[model samples]
Target chain A: MNSTLLRTSALRSALRAAAPKTSSRAGLAGTTFVRSKVTLPDLPYDYGALEPAISGKIMELHHSKHHNTYVTSFNNFSEQMAEAKHKEDIQTQIALQPLINFHGGGHINHSLFWENLAPTSKGGGEPPKGQLAKAINDNYGSLDAFKEKFNAALAGIQGSGWAWLVQDTQTGGIQIKTYANQDPVVGQFRPILGIDAWEHAYYLQYENRKAEYFKAIWDVINWQAAEKRFK
Target chain B: MSAPTYTLPPLPYAYDALEPHISAQIMELHHNKHHQTYITNLNSALRSQAEAVHASDITTQVSLQQAIKFNAGGHINHSLFWQNLAPASSVDAKSSSAPELIKQIKATWGDEESFREAFKAALLGIQGSGWGWLVKVETGKEQRLAIVTTKDQDPIVGKGETPIFGVDMWEHAYYLQYLNGKASYVENIWNVINWKTAEERFKGTRADAFRIFKASI
Candidate 1:
């Protein structure tokens, strides 16, 4: 985690350096900026490791095709945004907002989602311990009750979205929240566990039987990750 | 380079026209919110495209293609969808109202029931946000009926093809009323389908079928 944070900070510094200085037109014209591209993150486990919960084909497509599309599209739009900014083209910049939001949120959401799962051999589905377990029990009575509530929230989503178990930054209370489309959980809420309700996440394996996918996913959830986030 | 802006076409009937099969709440949101957003976005993107064209920025113009396609498709699909529905109690909703289209459907699928089943299957088979369409395809004086689907707000754009009618399979279309029972939504949508519109589209030219856009603009 520390190494990941370091790498992210380094990438940010590189991006800052690459950004054209609007005041220095001659400098910008002479120098070529080597922008740092946002690449797809490697999954912690093999695609098939989740097994009966999520199929290998589904994982492969979800990660490689769907998630990668978001990453690539986001990168493309980011480049366009930079150019638009350099040119001071406000209309073009405004038009790029939705694309940036959708693709950027997709990338962020999927990155968190991948970390929120694991294989059974690695303590996946093992109930949360310590503070996270206590928080769940304190807020929602029991783990079973919390799961039921979470699943209900998932089922209630009207369109492609995500159901997240989030901790309120100020109050420290755990709550269930749903976001439409690729909108990410941000601001006052920190997402501890996020289950994607997007059709692409489970349709290849479960098809229209999304309830089964929702139920089955709990079996492979990496509670340890949730616990870490809670702390 | 100024592009014409689009306005949301009013529903042909009241929001409650479909009743128990589809709720007024669903229709209200689907039309007023969802469909309106598409038109608004489409107009905005077109305006941006106009600016891009004026500035001779090929990259910006190219980047706006998806926004154009998605929003324009949404507008086209919803416009057609509204016209292809009537009150469940109206005479236009009956299968008997569309003799020519029914004859073609029977010829293609052997019976109306078989054709409906195939359409339902196409609707249910859509994995994500998409639409299922019953289209008229013409090939060298030979016209045929085919059921097809397009992913994520894509409208039917094939040459020599006209959408007779389409079903919005996006969860927002039925999730408020059907929840996860999409099969039930698929089964019940027939109650409000306007066969008269289907018949007209089947017998008319593609330009005639798409006359709704002209009226709106």
Candidate 2:
């Protein structure tokens, strides 16, 4: 959010908070709300950073065009949801869920997705070092085994989706899961890693050879990036 | 003995049956490869999920819903899909002139041409990978042909609607043959529709509804 939008949002929140508590008006009936405008986060590396595994063209389009659209749509939906909630419009709020899930996932999944890759020169694809390494060993037997399972999960998504390694919050264990069409990790799973399986993610470069795409993506997996989240 | 896993259902016709409209290559890949992958993963998820539940592994059980739903919906949807199509013989014998079915379709859509336009428009309107369906569903007291779509592999049954027929709109369904032009895929698929199967399904559901109504009376 820009500084101007920040000030406006703060002012709106203040005005709502100052409204009479005894009022029966729809908007004033609700407590003060501070809704943040979601903006697309910049990639940590150049578009061409993860060369050979992913192309600069795919990165640029995926980030600027695809991810940006998600951010823009999420913001729009967020604004609508805020308005609906303020008026206590249950039906409208319910209707906004599908849009929220899709665009919100696009924003969150892509945000996590970009950081999960790094240039090979920046130690991308290097083996894990700390707790994540031990966890991978304990849960999946070995890093190679984890990669094999993850690749199979990726290749096996029936349509557009994502493959993830997530922490089972209840058990404090890791498991592999697939999410349909931009759905981020739901349920009790906290995602530790994710790869976009949408055709847009790899279709241009790999065509229909998704096995090749999965194979190459591992070559660019940022263990260091993953480790920080795992810890 | 072990519990039976869902096996891939074979296509009713040869890979070449839907030719020129949806090529053999697309059919083969869609069925043999894509459909099979869903079942395989579903089976895997089912096994682990069963064990997780048996052992009270709540987290694993919860996390497995996506796998179970996506792959099972893939199976259910595709199984209906194969039976939904046939060799290009025009609307099939049963529904071509099925008065009641045609009446409902016309009532809901104004006319046959209007229904086609509306159905195709709904299918084309899907934002991403999903399916477009023509389903017979009750709203208040009347059953009507409600054209709807679902994202990814969510089947119509999940939405409390009995699908009369469905068209796969996933890019994998036609990208090999139609490329980016889904309009052509939607238009051509009509030629191969197995309306006989759809009519049978429609009649069966209506009969059941009638039976319940008569029982109540």
Candidate 3:
């Protein structure tokens, strides 16, 4: 069979296996094109909560405009893919890769970005506890050692990318990685902490001196959210 | 308006702040020349991409992919890299440390040395373009620290892991000083390791973990 037919069949099978949340069998049918819905995620805190570290304007634009564009594109891609599959079209599916990459990436990156931040008023300053703390000390000699290493790596990325604390799916251990553009973290690693380095992420507040802005962002990190995600 | 000219990010500390481990010359070049290139390229790409999209009347906006990835990644990566560094004098491991952070590391890895050895080994083992990390994992029962490696610009904390420490192994990270022998670079990078920030992260990780556990159960 053609690649389109194969992808369509695979997608159908996968959707079928999803245990359709909706009762209508129409939801499972391969005939009609049904667009998947993608909604804008609400920021957990008020727009100005991360002020000083992250300005309200940046947050407003990053979330409302930048992230919204991703959501819309993602939904469009899903609908188009669904339609292409129904029509037994493989070339179209392949062409949609960039759309999925850009929009899907935007959605995933921003979602993490929002959760990673919290108002400094909250216990955002609270540190790691128990086994997590133990591991940090043991590995780097001291927490300071880890920070130095982490920061050095963070500063090393060539351009617009993200610094992350991730879990290796293979070993179930945490690792740090950086991805450029909207590159998604593939496979087993799960992100626990992330720092956005895109210029827009800091420019207005720190100007060309990106380091100043980076230094400040840590003050508002949502450790509480990170802890929950880690668990 | 003409495109903004990108300059090298000025080092927060003197070239010798890191001293014996990372030389002043190395620091100067790394920050001033290398990082500056990334910024310049990122801005250049964005502008050209914007122009291309406008000229072609291609609403699909596909050509901007490379520009965004290359330039944007460069910008974000370097920004984090700058913040990650600090003077070694600022850290005090035994007494000045955050209690919870020290306690957690001791619980998981026995002692700081053991943890260092493991983390260092992970860093030393990178085969190609990649990084090594020490991170905290929040298990249902407790938060734990584990070490792992990754390829290219892959951020250690993407899908869900909290990154505590990372070691860069890319050629640009060490090539000027260590040349083709990455092992030497890996060994040397450790001299400038920052312990203070790692401690702060530990404090935050522990507190966060406890709160989550209590709330979940």
Candidate 4:
């Protein structure tokens, strides 16, 4: 993991402990805030590790630059949000909400994305076992069927966005979903795994060849990690 | 069963027709790639929504709100936007053409130049993806011009006001040519504003009070 991301994780834990009862996001009414600046989380693996699947250059830019901008912008928005809340500026708070969503979504989606993948050597393509496997089979017929449906959702996204395997909040049933831009399906559904269908994710290596990139991602998917989350 | 799909509204002029102000490349990509995607997604959302209604899955239907709104707004905004623009060569600035519209704008903002500035201000002041609209609204038994901005892909049609004209503030509209300079793109856009079409829209909206998006659709 990037050391900054590690620090961010540590800070998040500390913040959770520190402000367990209060809120500061979007300039909502809240108590004093313990400053929490978002930081770029390091990619868990080397850039070249996803090689034949995703080029090192793409990975580097995605993580270092793209994700980094989100982190920095998120932090800035957070600071501004805090100031607005501090001053009880309702109009300013309303204005800042979109920026918060955009940057916050980028931060969250990218952070989850880094954890969502692993190199081939580390059981990336390994299928789920036990309860997770049973659940997949029950809901989607089979793992292959799940992939087929999920990739269809991925391929159909209108613009920059992600296709996700999200557990429905109501029934805990897994469903394939897509969200445009940096939107993360975290509020009503529990996102188990996400595949970025953003052009930047594949434009470099695949160059508008989305279908090929969708197929290639299976080689680097950290199934073991995702299954652990599902269970 | 026949499906209701939103078709991309044909540009008022040729793809390269806007020229110098809005490059053919920008218009082509904006129409074909961006606007086309919105139409496709809107169709898919409406279809799935119909299925959810059939299945009695209210939760799933509710879950699709963002998709429905965003894509529907995209389709509505773009369709109106294409009609609101024309080639610079096509415009005849004869004040006699839209005397009433010009008089109303002048009354509202003191002059056309100030109205343009106010519109630009509303647009430049926007924080993220959205649209800037010049609308004819009845504030209190008086028809007046109001500058409104809607965030992301939210349409202006349902604002209880008739839209005179609107500019797509989405980055996809001008990012290639304008890059980060949205003000520049918006500034040049005025050169192609179809006063004649806007006059017709104004008259049509005045003809029927309930002529917004949902009502017309």
Choose the strongest candidate by TM-score: 4
Alpha-carbon runs more than 4 Å astray in model 1: A1-231
Residue-wise lDDT of candidate 1 within B1-217, one digit each (tens)? 7898889999988899889889998898889988998899899999999999999999999999988998899999999999998888999999999999999899999999999999999887664578999999998899999999987788987899999999998877876676556799999999999999999999999999998898887
Grade the docking of candidate 2. Answer: incorrect
Q: Estimate, for each residue in A149-221, the C-alpha lDDT of model 4 and write its tens digit.
A: 9899997665568888888778878878888777756666877899988656765566535799999898899
The lDDT per prediction is: 0.85, 0.78, 0.63, 0.76
Instruction: List runs of model 2 lying over 4 Å from the truth.
Output: A1-37, A41-51, A54-65, A138-141, A152-160, A167-181, A185-190, A203-212, B1-25, B36-76, B82-100, B111-130, B137-143, B148-162, B174-217
**What C-alpha RMSD does candidate 2 show over the true interface residues after superposing them?**
3.6
Which regions of candidate 3 deviate over 4 angstroms?
A1-35, B1-217
Interface RMSD for model 4 amounts to: 5.1
**What is the model-wide C-alpha lDDT for candidate 1?**
0.85
Q: What is the TM-score of chain A in candidate 1?
A: 0.85
For all predicted structures, in order, the TM-scores are 0.55, 0.64, 0.47, 0.65
- How well does candidate 2 reproduce the true complex, by DockQ? 0.20
Cα lDDT tens digits for candidate 4, B16-131: 88888888877887888778888888889899998888889999999989899889888888877887788888753233456778888888899989999999999976644678
Clashing pairs in 4: A2-A42
Clashes of each: 0, 0, 74, 1
Model 4 off-target regions past 4 Å? A1-36, A42-69, A85-99, A117-134, A151-162, A167-174, A177-190, A196-220, B1-9, B19-21, B29-76, B88-130, B139-141, B149-156, B169-192, B203-217
lDDT of 2 by residue, A171-191 (tens): 888889998887767567877
Error of 1 at B68 (Å): 0.6
